[model samples]
Target: MLPYLRRLIRDEDALLQYSAQIRGLTAGDIYIGSYFSVAANWLPQIIQAFQQAYPAVHVHIEECANKVMYDGLEEGRFDCCITTWRPFSGDWIPLCEDEMVMWLPENHPLARAEVYPLKQLCHESFIEPLPQQDTDVVRILKEEHISYETRYTAIDNYTTYRMVEAGLGVSMNNRLMTAQWQGRVAILPMDPPHTITIGIAIPSRDGASPAVKKFIHYVQQGISQILAPR
Candidate 1:
């Protein structure tokens, strides 16, 4: 009976704490899960804005694979995620669209080609990135029935970029992934141009904590300003 009473008291205290945090966004924690590329390209500015608005609200970011990020969102382990939009049982707020492009050594014959032919992959040594995961590159190749030689398997896009820079092999990835990279790699659009939508995924905005809601709003605003016509 004493243990039950203590448990009830703890539950009530937790409820009270949650209520207070939501009533006035004075304090709360928001868990954000994202892909490495998304976190790198989109999170910094938005997070800065959010922090300025609510300094007391803590932001925790986790970088994970696409599947893991979406799984965490469904399991309530993540309040929100910045990732490529896919068919999931959640709400998605599109932030931007990214174009899929091929990476080649600057000295390669087709390096400056206007568009890389999908079938041409058959002649190149491909540097497959994240073979364990169905990344956009892998999915695009498979869906288009394009076959290539996987001479190297990179753990991430950065490694893939290095491999391509070293003339080890060619690769394909979203253009946004190369936003911060300065290496000499020729990025070309695919013969059949492919694009992916990247956005925020939330279980339910209506059920979000105050901090999470505010963070989402800031993300929307920040992205809007960045994407607006200059």
Candidate 2:
């Protein structure tokens, strides 16, 4: 056998012995890709708890917009993804469901309304992330034939919130994104109450590594706790 191949086999054997002796994992690596909103709102808390349970594990997170998250997952760049939309196939596990809301400037006319209808905002200037590419918001708007003026196109949620705060325009967002900017923006529940189910998309439950499985369970538990009855 080649010297390199022999050395690699020897190293693998040593690693197995070392792992058996320690009774602790030596390599616990996982990659997660998800929207920035999920990363900003919930990931830190979840990671803190996860690390406490498995100190040896290493987690790498990629924060992109929704479409990027999905693309990364399909490309095998990520072990799993957290997103509002579910995979069309049967491999996904549902985590949580949240209602969508309209985010408007504090002084905007719709701020005083209990609920904002999509049709009413047709003429209002809209601030959204990159249409179709970055997010699915544009598709919904276009499907409804809601004519809107694009005031600004932000790259991420923070920038979107900043633009809204500056009274640049109104926008629609999920509860996860809107919750963080609650006091700064006027959050009005949408009419007919559009809801998005957020969940983890993995390759397959049976094919997941131990670390990945643990993290998925942790996420589900954390979300359940958050949504539990008060």
- What are the models' TM-scores? 0.88, 0.83
Candidate 1 segments exceeding 4 Å error: 1-18, 21-23
Q: Please report, in order, the local distance difference test score of every candidate based on alpha carbons.
A: 0.82, 0.74
Candidate 2, which segments miss by more than 4 Å at Cα?
A: 1-26, 86-90
TM-score of 2: 0.83
What is candidate 1's lDDT per residue for 1-230, written digit by digit as tens? 65456445534543654787767644566778987876898789988878887887788999876777777766667778988876788788888888999999999999988999989999999999878665778778889999899999977779889999999989998888898989989999998999988888987767666667778888888888977999
Model 2: lDDT of residue 213: 75
The sequence of per-residue lDDT tens digits that candidate 2 reaches over residues 201-221 is: 766776666677788888888
